[model samples]
Target chain A: MPNCDKVTALVSASLDHSLPLHKRLAVRLHFLICVWCQRYLTQVRFLREAVREHPERLESAESPSSTALSPGARERIGQALRDDRR
Target chain B: MAGNLSDPQTWLEQHGDYLYRCAMLRVRDATVAEEMVQETFLAALQAKDRFAGQSSERSWLVGIMKHKVVDHFRKSVREQPVSDVELMNDEFTGLFDKDGHWKIETTGPKEWMDPSSALDKAQFWQVLRRCLDGLPPRTSRVFALREIDDMPSEEICAAMKLTKSNLWVMLHRARTHLRSCLEQNYQGLTT
Candidate 1:
């Protein structure tokens, strides 16, 4: 039986791609007796889904004053655009 | 000509903030994100003649920004020496014991109750942003590209010039760190 350490790594990898049969079986067997590993899987899967579904949450959650484009950058880009036009 | 493309003069006033925030979320750097938004605008201006208005102009610019972000990634990977030391570090090894089981005392996974509901909480997103910021720059970039951009593994491999296995390792490390960070930080908020 794969230990929790190995099982957890496989659990993370399983998110990226399907595990080969033997590795898949190993993870499943470990999960049967391991609540911690089970919780790990659930939490990571939740994290992935949360990030994938609502990425805007992070943007909105960010402090606007910090992440927003500065006036200087805006002017620089505008000037570049105008220069391109001419 | 038939499309509803906005004038280039108005792009900064209109879409600048939105585009900057979008790039900031992905790139996690103010200067680079600003540069990306700018590049996207310039590219859009050059290609404005081709805008078929299939999507909103904002979405069209966002599409171009995505390419810019990916191009930034590709360039960074090219410029930096591809080192495996960071990827092989395995920071979580201490969480496991000699027998490969979780230590269960100091570093085992904690049970988070109703994690899905945390997604609705603004504090949760803040904690997530901090956690992502805590990751190694390259690892976080790879994670953002894969998770946020929804880029496929093969495309990520090609862009970063990483083998599939390397990409998997970096992503696994990123997810592991973020999961633990969220469980520790966000779990505190619920209690």
Candidate 2:
């Protein structure tokens, strides 16, 4: 019997499609009785879906998001690419 | 000719910002992301004849950016930090009880309240991106490469110079953190 610790770990790997068939079966069996692990699995899947749907925001100086890149950096890269063209 | 592949200025105007965002999400640094996008443009220009009119112009550029992202990680392979292992262990321990079972009441699933709709909303993605950013940089990179880019495990291991187990462990920790973060932060937004 795969314990909850191993089962939860397997749930994560399962998302990556990395788990083997037997372990996957074991996880499925574990999930039968473990509502908590099942919920954990759902949460992970939800996170994955939410992320996949997250539109990639273009880097902007005024955007407060951490994903923003500096305008100077963008200009420097554009300049480098232009130089490469010449 | 059919697409904007031949025009550098148009490519920069159309896809530069988008490519920069993709690269930035994976590499998590301003300077590095900038370099990767520039490299992608140069590579796209050099391989213009091979464009084949297959994928979208943005995807073709993104394909090149993916390679640049891998190459950047390949060049900077550092010793796996001890803190990573410690953090993984801590996250694991927190999720399971001593008997290797969930602490039940605390871990029960609450109503996600129209999960699909919440997922479709832009606000949910903003929160999701913020949650991803909160993860440790290395872990976030691995998760983004594997989940976001859909990069193969073998390629991720080879490019990042990670052992299979290490990659699995890091991915597990990343998922655990992301799940909890979403639950805490976005539960209110759902439904």
Candidate 3:
């Protein structure tokens, strides 16, 4: 339980990128000292990068136009479009 | 509540691809993804005045799309719900073995590096996609919400019905797993 509490403190800062400069400085210093935290930072960095890249190439791999929409569905959207104009 | 968002052509030109890409990552079906994107736009159009411009228009649109995805998942109940996922919790227990025993030290502030051209190219995305697809469905969904959706962890806890501790546990686990997978699979220089 105590350990969990310790991790909780770190989690928000990690997510927010909002640690105070000194604290941020301390974390970087620790990353330099600790292999585990260094690896942990690396993981955080990679996961963030992965998420950013997901949208870039998603359309090319799966083209929406290549999949056929039902005529009825198309008409509903078409009607919705017309209604929006009115 | 209605303005530029009411302008169909202007809205599409501004947000079409952004919404489409966000929707595709979650739904994984192009047609359904397109519908989700369209639905997001329409919903935003209806709620335009609520846009306080607090977050980027991209984040705002993705936030709506995320709720729609959550609803879709809840209704579909796919093969497994998040509770059914018996993820390995022991893996990261060491880092938090004792509260305040070992504080994280971030001194040098490791400079962020752009992935090399080779990694930025097709092979990188392929390796990454494969790794993401390899994650358990629930973990992947949580990871996507936190990382891809760019929603705050607190917001994720509320949306996913998870406690902050549980969310962190899952988040740490997911980040650790992704790190290992990307490092093992992709030849990223930093990883």
Instruction: Indicate which candidate wins on TM-score.
Output: 1
Please give each candidate's TM-score.
Answer: 0.86, 0.83, 0.55
Off by over 4 Å in 3: A1-37, A49-86, B1-21, B27-35, B44-119, B188-191
Docking class of 1: medium
Off by over 4 Å in 1: A63-66, B1-7, B48-57, B79-85, B88-90, B188-191
True contacts kept of 2: 0.48
* Tens digit of per-residue lDDT, candidate 3, span B1-191: 53323355465556666566566556655677668766776777677777876776766777788788877655554342345243554434433435433334322122235554534577666666666655565566677777776778777666666666666666666665665565566655344
RMSD of 1: 2.8
- Name the weakest run of 10 consecutive residues (lDDT summed) in model 1 chain B: B79-88
Top DockQ hit: 1
lDDT of 3: 0.58
Local distance difference test, each candidate: 0.81, 0.73, 0.58
Model-by-model DockQ, in order: 0.65, 0.47, 0.21
TM-score head-to-head 1 vs 2, winner: 1
Ranking by TM-score: 1, 2, 3
lDDT of 3 by residue, A1-86 (tens): 22222333364347744656766566656555455555456557655865566655532333333323345555555566557757
Candidate 1 on B63-178: residue-level lDDT in tens?
89989999987887663544655564666776788898887876778777677777788889988888887777678888988887789999998888888888888888888888
